[model samples]
Target: MPEQTQDDTGRDRDDDGRARNARPRDRFGRPLPFGSAGVPRIPEDLDLPPAETLDYAQRLLDEGLAFNAHEVLEAAWKNGPFAEKSLWQGLAQFAVGLTHIQRGNAKGARTLLKRASDRLSAYGTAPYGIDSPGLVDRAHTLLMALEQGKPISDTDLRARLTISH
Candidate 1:
């Protein structure tokens, strides 16, 4: 076997010594071989305004790439202003809940969907015109379907992330 590089945590490290996986990932965000073609990655430092972030994440969701959408939402949560942390975090978790459904983890999907709903409920007057209550309803609907063992369709999973202006 070829020699392997070692890091303090046995994970890949970036130039700044931060744990960073350089492996490419598929549409569902599963890591692939180093040289394999993969979906374009969302930057870890992506810092878009709320509207732009929602637009980008919505496009990803429409493409049935919920995992990538989660990455974009997670970046927003990390880089957005502190006041909107819960909002972004809930959106990220919502995307992740969809991802878990796609990956066939119904239990995890249900848990995250419920948690996202709970978080979003606290933001009835969410910023950037996000339909927080709508999202919470969607999460509850999805969670119920999961609990009842109903097969979830792509159309049901890919609801608009924001309301029309």
Candidate 2:
């Protein structure tokens, strides 16, 4: 495959016909050269039951599809009942923080994680099947690791996060 250049502004045209500039991304929104041809997207109606909505985000998170998971959470935040908006927003911010990690933006990741932690903390733990306490704890830990110059990976994130009822 030819190397990408400044002139390669056009999307998805490669010399060897191999995939390039594909829009499909990993959980953190980083472009992946392969896989995820069929990532699940949220439906038009945001009326899914709480369990189902959380389940979808958990599945995406477990698969290292953090950005995809964020889409689900963001939709819920934007479209779900007003009372639960903060919870959903926190979840979306959490996923976005992970996306920042994927993008190798440590500062951004820390900032988002801190903000998410604060927001989710307001809802307390076990709100609508989300473990805000656990999420905030892990977010702080990850932030500490980043502060110490430790590297993070999808595998590490998967090991740390577990969405539960």
Measured by TM-score, the strongest candidate is: 1
TM-score of each: 0.92, 0.72
TM-score between candidate 2 and the true structure: 0.72
Query: Per-residue lDDT of 11-129 in model 1, one digit per residue for the tens?
Result: 77766666777779987788998899999988777888888999999999999999999999999999888989899999999999999999899998988898889889986689887
Cα lDDT of model 1 overall? Answer: 0.87
Query: Over the stretch 118-137, how does candidate 2's per-residue lDDT look in tens digits?
Result: 89888765455467778898
Pairs of residues clashing in candidate 1: none
- Reference-based TM-score, model 1: 0.92
**lDDT of each candidate versus the true structure:** 0.87, 0.73
Off by over 4 Å in 2: 1-27, 30-47, 159-165
Alpha carbon lDDT of residue 47, candidate 2? 58
